[model samples]
Target: MRIGLLTEGGYPYARGEARLWCDRLVRGLGQHEFRLYALSRDREQERAGWVDLPAQVTQVRTAPLWTAEVDGTWYGRRARRRFAQHYGDLAAGLCAGPAGAPGQGGYSPAEADRFRSALYGLAELAREEGGMVAALRSEEAVRALERVCRAPGAPRAAREARVTDLLLVGAHLEQALRPLSLDWYEEGELGSVDLCHAAAGGLAALPGLLARHFHGVPLVVTEYGVPLRAHYLGSADAPPAVRALLAAFHGRLAAEVYRSAAVLTPGNTHVRRWQERCGADRSKVRTVYPGMSAARFAGAGERPGGRAGAAGAGAEPGTLVWVGRIEPSKDLVTLLHAFAAVRQRVPGARLCVAGSAPDPEGAAYLLHCEELAGRLFPGDPPVEFVEMGGPAAPGLADVYARGAVIVLSSVVEGFPVSVVEAMFSGRATVSTDVGAVVEVVGGTGLVVPPRDPRALAEACVALLGDPERRDRLGAAARARAMELFTVEQNVAAFHRIYLEVAGRCPARRIAEADAAAPRPFAVPAELRVAGAGSVEVTR
Candidate 1:
C-alpha cells in the first residue's frame, strides 16, 4: 500500500524529535511505499537537510511553516465575497469560543457549521486563487477581526484585543492556511496514496485533511504531544485576548481533525485522554507508545552494572544519573535541591547531570544549577556536569551504563522517552509523578511527587541505600522494556492497526467505481430455474 507519511519539524530532518522513529518505521515496513509530506520548522532545519532515506520511501514533499512568503494575488470580485463570508465565520467562531459551552462567547452548532464551511471555503478559494497571504493581511481582514472581537457575545478578553493582537493572529492564520493553496492534492501526488498518516495535528496535518477531502483516502492521526496542548502551555505569557483567540482556533481545528480522521493514535494514555476530551471518538482512539531502539542497551541490561564499577571505580557507589535536555521543564533546580538533601544523609553520594542545553535560556539555567550545586555542597564530588558533545562520550548507552541509578525530575512530560531508555538499560529509576512516568515505570522504579525536592531526595536515598533492591528493580525494568517498549513490537502493532483500518475503510477508487456502477436487474432465462410455480433467480 502507498502511505502518505506526514510530519512537522521532524522525520527526514537531521535534528528533530520524531526523525529516528520515523526512519525506523520506514525501514522496518519495507513492503509499503511511503511518500513523505513534511513541514519544515525553520531555515536551520531546511539547511540541516534530510537524513538518508531508504528505497521504501518513494517520494518527498516539504513546505515551510516557520516563515510566510507572500503569494500576493487578490481574489476576483465574486471570490472576494466568498472569502469575506467564510473568513468572517472562521474569525467569528474563534472569537466566540470552543464547542459545548453555553454562554457569552461560547460556541453554538450554527457557529461550528459556519466555521467548518468558511474554513473549507477559504481552502477552496486558496486553491483557485494563488494564496491568502496578501488578502489575510488586508484592511478587510483586520476589519473582520475587529467585528468579531467587538461582537455582542465576544469574550471579555477578546473584546479587549488591540489592533496589534488582531494583526498577529491574522498573520498566523494566514500562514496556517497557506497549506490550503499547496498543489499536493493533484492526482499524481497525495490523491494516489492509499492512506494518509499524519504525524501530528495543526499545520502538519493540513495536507492529510486535504488528501482525505480531495481524494477518498483515509487519514490516520498520531499525536505524541498534542499540538493544542503545547499551544495552551506555551501561550501562558501571551496577552489574554491573543491566548483566547489562538486557543479557540486550535481547539476547533483539533475537534474537526478528530471528527474527520479514520483513527486517532496517541503515544500514551495521557495524550489519549487529551484527545478524548477534545471530542475524539473513543472507538477510534488508540494508544500506541513510541518505540525505543533497545539494541544499544542490550549489553548494559544483560551485564547489569558490570561496567558501572569500571567507569567510576574510585567514585562513590551511590551515584545518580539524570540524562536529558537541560531545560527548566525538566525541573533540574528541584533535582539539585533534592541532591543537597540526599547529601545531608549520604555525604559521599554524587549526582551526574549528563546532557547539553538546547537553548540559551537552558544554558543559563544550567549555570544557575551549577552555582546552586556549589553553594549547597561547598566541596566534595563537585556536582559532575558532563556535556556529552564530542567523541569523549559517544552516546547515551555509555552515560546510562556508568551510573548506579537513573533519575527523572520533570514536572511535565509526554511518554518520557528518557525513562524508557533507562529501563532498556536496566538501570534502577526514580521518577516524579507526572505525565506517563508512573505508567512507564510501572513498579519497576520508585515514584515521587513532582516539584518536591524532599520526596525526590527520599526516593533517591532509598534506591541508593540498597544494591539488591536496585538490582531487582533494574531487572524488572529491563524485562518490562523488552516486553512492551521495543521498536519491533511498536512497528508490529502499527502494522496490525494499519491493516485493521484498511479493512474497515472502503477501497478508495474501487469502491467509488462500484458505487457508481449500474446493477443488472434480471438474470437470463436460460440461467434461471423453476421453483414450484415461480421462476428462481440465478447468477
Candidate 2:
C-alpha cells in the first residue's frame, strides 16, 4: 500500500511530540510505501534535522510555520475576484459564533452543510490559482475578514474587533491555513497513495483533507491528543476577537475532518470524549491506546526477584518513583505535600522524582518543587527531586526497578505514559484519575482524585503497607500492558484498518490526470511503458 503520512511538529524530526510513534509505525510496516508531508514548527526544529528514515519512505515534503515572508505571487483581476468570493465565505463562516449561526457548531445538518460548502469552495479556488499566499495576505483579505467581524449577528466579540485585532487575526489565519495552498494533491503526491493517514488533527490533517477532496483518497485520522483542545488552551490569553474567530474556525475544521475521514482513532477514551464533544460522529470513532516498547524494561519486569511482593527484588524499601518531564502541569506541589502525609503513615518512605526539564518554565518549576520539598522536609528531605538520568536519579527502567510503587501526580495529562512504563516494568502504580489514567489503568492499579494530597497519600500508604496487593497489581498491570498497549497490538490494529479502508474505497489515482498532472501516468499518450512502470517514449 502507498500511504501518505501527514504530520505537524512530528515525525522525521529528531525531537517532536509524535516523532517516536511515527518512526516506529513506519519501521513496523515495512510492506507499505510511505510519502511524508511534515510541517516544521520553528527554525530550531528544522536545524535539529530529521531521524534516519526507512528505505520504504520514498518522498518527504516540508513547509514552515515559523516564518511569514511575502508570498509575492500576483493574481490576475479575474482570479482576485474569485479569491475574494471564496475567502469571503470562509471568513464569514469563521466569524459566525455558535449563538448566531446554526452551521457554526457543525452539529446541525444545515450548519454542517454551510461549513462544508464554504470550506471546499476555498479549497477549489486555491487548487486552480496555484497558491493562496498572495490572496490570504492581501489587503482585500483583511477587509473581507473585517467585514465578517463587523457583520450583524456575528459573534459579539468578533463584532467588537478593533482594526489591529482584524489584521492580526487575518495574518494568523493565513499561517494556519497555509497548507491549503500546498501542491500536494497531484498525481505523484497524495493522489497516488492508497490511504491518507493523518498523525494528528487540525494542521496535520489539512493535507489529507485536500487529498480526499481532490482525489477520492480515503483518510484515517489518529489522535492521541485532540488539536482543537490544545488550541483552546493555548489561545486563552489572546484578544477576545482573535480567540473567538480562531476557536470557531478550528471547531468547524475538526468537525469537517471527522465527517470526511473513513475512520477516527483516538488514543484513549479520554481523547474520544473530547472529539465527540467537538461534534465527531460517535459511530466513526475508535479508541486505540498508544503503544510502548516492553523489551527495554524486560530486565526489571522478568527478574525472578521482581515478583510483586518478593523481598529483596531490586526495589528499595518504601521508595516511590516518579518519572516524566518536570513541568507545572505535573503538579509536583501536590506530590510534595502528599509525600509529607505519606511520611506520617510510613516514616521510612522515600520519594524519587526523575525527569528532565524540557524548557525554562519547566526548569523553574522544578526548582520551585525542590524548594517546596525542603520546606516540607527541611534538612535531609525524604523527597529526592532529581533531574535527568545521572547518579542522583538513573534511567527510567532503573527508576522503576528501584521502587515498589510508581506514582503519577499530574493534574493535566493525556495518556499518563509514565504509568504505562511502570506497568511494563512490572511495578504497582498509584495515579490520579485524570485524562486517560483510568482507561489506561483499567483496574490494574490504584486511582485517586487529582490534587488531593490526603487521598493520594492514603492510596500510596495502602499499596506500600500491603506487599501482597502490590505484587498482585504489578503482575496484573504487566500482563495488561503486554496485551493492549504493546507495539505489536498497535501495528496489528492499524494494519487491519488500512486493508479495510483500501479494500472498500479504491484509490483516486486517475482523478489527478483530469487536471493535466505532469506525471507520466497522467499522460499515457506521450509515453509507452517499456518495463516495470518505466516510460520509454518520454523525451
Candidate 3:
C-alpha cells in the first residue's frame, strides 16, 4: 500500500519535535511505499535540508509555513460572492466559540452550516486563484472578521477583539489554510495514496482532511503530543481576545480531524484524554507508546564490575541522573533545590544533568541552574551539567549507567521519552506525578508531587539509600520498557491499526491492466518429452 505521511515541522527536517519517531515509523514499515508531505516551520529548518530518506519513500512535497507569497490570480464576481459566503461562515463559526452552547452565544446549526460552506468556498477560490495569502492579509479579511465578531450570536470575548487581534488571527488562519492552494490534492497526488497518516494534529492534518474530503482516502492521525495542548500552553500569555479566537479555531480544527479520522493514535493516556475532550470517539482512539531504540542499553542490567559496564569506576555509588533537554518545564530549579536537600541527608549523593539546552531560553535557564547549584551546595557533591553534543556526545545509555537513580522533575509532560530511555537503561527513577509520567513509570519508579522540592528530594534520597530496592526497581523498569516501549512493539501496533482502519474503508477496485495478474504456470516441453536431455541445467 502507498501511504501519504503528512507532517508539520518534522521528519525530513533535520530538527523538529517529531522527526525521530516519524523516521523510525517510515523505516520500520518498509513494506508500504511512502510519500512525504512536509510543512517547514522556518527558513533555517528548510536550509538545514532533510534527513536521508529510505528507498521506500516515493516522493516528497513541501511547503513553507513561515514565508508569505502573493497569489494574484483574479476571482470572477461569482467566485468572489462564493468566497464571501463561505469565508463569512468560517469566521462566524470561529467568532461564536467552539462549544455549541446557547448561553455562550455559540453558532446555531444553520450558522455552522454557513461557516462550513464559506470555508470550503474560500478554499475553492484559493484553488482557482492560486493562493489566498494576499487576499487573507487584505482589508477585506479584517472586515470579514469584524462582521463575524459583531454578529448577533458572537461570543463576548470575540466581539471585543480589536483590529490588531483580528489581523493577527487572520494572518495565522491564512498560513494554516495555505495547504488548500497547494497542488498536492489533485488525483495524481494525495488522491492516489491508499492511506493518509498525519504525524501530528493541527496544520499537519489539514492535507489529510482535504484528501479525505476530496477523495475517499482513509486518514490515521498519530499524535505523540497533542498539538491543541501546545497551542493552549503557548497562548497562556497572549491577550484574552487573541487567545479566545485562536483557541476556538484550534478547537474546531481538532474536532473536525477527530470526527473524520478513521483511527486516532495518541502516544500516551494524557494525549488520549485531550483527544476525547475534542470529540474523538472513544472506540476510534488507541494509545500507542512512542518507541525507543534499546540496543545501546542491552548491557544495562550487568553489574558495575562486569566487562560490559563502562561506567564501573566513574559512576558515584548514590548519584542521580536527569537526562533531557534543559527547559523551564523540566523544572530544573525545583530539581536543583531538591538536590540541595538530598545532599544534607545523603552527603555522598551527586546529581548529573545530562543533556543540552534546546533553545536560547533553555540555555539561559541552564546557566541560572548552574548558579543556583553553586549558591545552594557550595561545592560539595556538586550539580554537574553535561552537554550532549551531536554525534560526539556520550551515548544516553552511558549517561544512565553513570547513576544509581534517574530523576524527572517536569511540571508538565506528555509522553516523557527520556523517562522511557532511562527505563531501557535499567535505571531506577524518581519522577514528578504529572501527565503520563506516572503511567509510564507504573510501579517501577518513585513518584512525587511536581513543584515540591521536598517531595522530590525525599524520593531521590529513598532510592539512593536503598540499594536493593533500587536494583529491583531498575530491573522492573527495564522489563517494562522491553514489554511496551521497544520499536518492534510500536511498529506491530501501528501495522495492526493500519490494517484495521483500511479494512473499514471501502476497498479500491483496480482495472485488469493495473492489477498484477498471476503468471500462468506451464510444464516445460522437455519434461513432457520424457527423458529429453537427462535433466539438469548447470548454472
Candidate 4:
C-alpha cells in the first residue's frame, strides 16, 4: 500500500512532537511504501535536520509554516471575483460564533459546508492560478474580513472587531490556510497515495483533507492532542474579537476534518472527548494509545526488590520522582509543597525533579520552583531538580528506577507520557486527575486532584509506607503498560486500521490500464500459500 503520512512540526525532524512514535510506526510497517509530507515549524527546526529514514520511506516533501513570502501570482478580473466569493465565505465562518456553543456554536451543517466549500474552492483556485500567497496577504483580504465582521446577524464580537483586529486575524488566517497553496496535490504526488494518515489535527490534517477532496484518497486522522484546544489555550492573550474569530475558524476546520475523515484515531479517551465535542462522529473515533518501547525498562521491572532493585545500591526507598518538561503547567510549586507534607508524614522523604527547561519561560519557572523548594525545606533541601540526560539524571529508565513512587503534579496535561514510562519501569505512580491521567492510570496507580498538595502528599505517603501495596501496584502497572502501550500493539492497530479503511474506501486507481494500476489483492491467496503444490486459484 502507498501511504501519505502527514505531520506538522514533527517527524522526521530532529525535534518536535510525535517524532519518535512516527519513526517507529514507519519502521514497524516496512511492508507498505510511505511518502512523508511534513511542515517545518521554523528555520531552526529545518536547520536541526531529520532523523535517519528507513528504506520503505520513498519520498519526503516539506514546507515551512514560519515564512509566507509573496508568490507573485497576479490574478485577473475573473480570478479576483472567485477569490472574493471564497474569501468572503471563509471570513464569515470565522465571524460566526464560538465552537461547540449551544445553538450558535458556529458549526451548524450549513455553516460547516460553507467553510469547507470556501476552503476547497480556494484550493482549486490556487491550483489553477499558481498560488494565493499574494492575494491572502493583500488589502482586499483584510477588507473582505472587515465587511464580514460588520455584516448583519454577525456575532457581537465580530461586530466589535477593530481595523487592527481584522488585520491580525487576517494574518493568522493566511498562515492557517497556507497549506491550501502548497503544490502537493498533483496526480503524481498526494493524489497517488492509497491512504492519507494525518499525524495530528488542525494544520497537519489540512493537506490530507485536500488530498481526499482532490484525489479519491482515503484519510485517517490520529490526534494525540487536539490542535483546536491548544489554539484556544495559546491564544488566550489575543484581543477578544481576534480570539473569537480564531476559535470559530479552528472549530469549523476541526469539524470539517472530522466529518471528512474515514477514521479518527485519538490517542486517549480525553482526546476523543474533545474530538466528539468538536462534532466528530462517535462511530468514526477510535482511541489508540501512543506506542512506547518497553524493552529498555523490562529488565528494571523484573527485579526482585521491585522499585529499589532497579535504583542500584544507593536507591532511596522514600524518593518521589517527577519527570517531564519543566513548565508552569507542570505546577512544580504544588509538587514541592506536597513533598513538604510527605516529609512530615514520612521523615527523610526525598523528591527528585528530572526534566529540561525547553524555553526561557520554563527556565524561570524552574528557578521559581527551586526557590520555593528551598523555602519549604530550608538548607540541605531534600528536593533536587536535575536536568534530564545530565550528569545527575542519566536516562529515563535509570531515573524511573531511582524512586519508589513516580509523581505527576501537572495542572494541565495531554496523554501523561511520564506516567506511562513509570508504569513500564514497574514503579507505582501518584498523578493528578488531569487530561488523560485517569484513563492512562486505569486503576493501576493512585490519582489525586490537581493542585491539591494534601491529596497528592497523602497518596505518596501511602505508597511509601506500604511496600507490599507499592509492589502490587507496580506489577499491575507494568502488566497494563505491556498489554496496552507497547510498540507492537500500536503498530498492529494502525496496520489493521489501514486494511479496514482501504477495504471500505477503495484506493484510487492510478491509470486506465489494469496492469499499471495497483490492486488490493493482486496475488491469489492459494498461489501465495506455501506447501500447496501448484493449486489452481479461482478469482
Which has the greatest TM-score? Answer: 4
In candidate 2 the C-alpha lDDT for residue 342 amounts to 95
Give each model a TM-score: 0.90, 0.91, 0.90, 0.93
**lDDT per residue (tens digit) for residues 1-539 in model 2:** 77899999998898788898888889898877788999989999999999999998989999887765656667899888978887887788786545433323344566566767877777787788777787888899999988888788887899889999888888888988888778888867887877899999998998898898888788999999879989998999999988998888888889888878899999998898877776677877777778789888877777655443232258999999899999988998999999999999899999999899978999899889988888899888888866775576567777788998999999989988999999888889999989999989998899999999999999999999998888888888888888999988888778777766665663344444346653322212222344886745422
Report lDDT per candidate. Answer: 0.81, 0.83, 0.80, 0.87
lDDT of 1 at 358: 72
Off by over 4 Å in 2: 99-107, 304-312, 389-393, 507-539
- For model 3, residues 1-539, the per-residue Cα lDDT tens digits are 67899999988899887898888988998877789999999999998889999988989999988886786756677766766667777887787644453312243546445555665677667777776667777777778889988888888888898988888888888887888878888766887777899999988998998888778789999999889989999999987878988887787788778878899999989889888877788988998999878887876745555322222224569788999988899999999999889989998788899988868999899999888888887746478888997787887778888888889999988888888888877778899999899899999999999999999999988888887788788878888888999998998888778766655566554223344752111111111122867664211
Which prediction has more favorable lDDT, 2 or 4?
A: 4
Candidate 1 pairs with clashing backbones: none
Candidate 3 residue-wise lDDT at 154: 80
Worst 10 residues of 2 by lDDT: 518-527
Worst 10 residues of 4 by lDDT: 521-530
Model 4 regions lying over 4 Å from their true place: 98-106, 304-315, 390-393, 512-539
User: How well does candidate 3 match the true structure, expressed as C-alpha RMSD?
Assistant: 7.6
Task: Give per-residue CA lDDT, model 4, range 1-539, as digits (tens).
Answer: 78999999999999999899999999998888899999989999999999999999989999999998889899999999999999999998776654454322235566777888999999999999999999999888999999998999898988999999999998998998899899999977898788899999999999999998898788999999989999999999999999999988888888888888999999999999888877788888778999999989866687654432332222468899999999999999899998999999898899999999979999999999988987888879999888985666587788888888899999999999999998888888999999999999998899999999999999999888888788788888888899999999999899878777766674355652446654543221121223659554322
lDDT for model 1, please: 0.81
Tens digits of per-residue lDDT for model 1, 1-539: 67899998999899776888888888988777889988888899999888999998879998888877677687788988888888898999887655574321235667767777888888788878877777787788888989989989899999999989998888778777778877788767888777899888777888888888777688999888889989999989988888889899888788778878899888888888888877778889888888789988766777554432122222248898999888899999999999989988888788889998878999999999888888887856548899977577657887887778899999988888889988888888999999988788998999999999999999999888888788888888888888888889878877766776666665554222434653221111112334776664332
Error of 1 at 251 (Å): 0.7
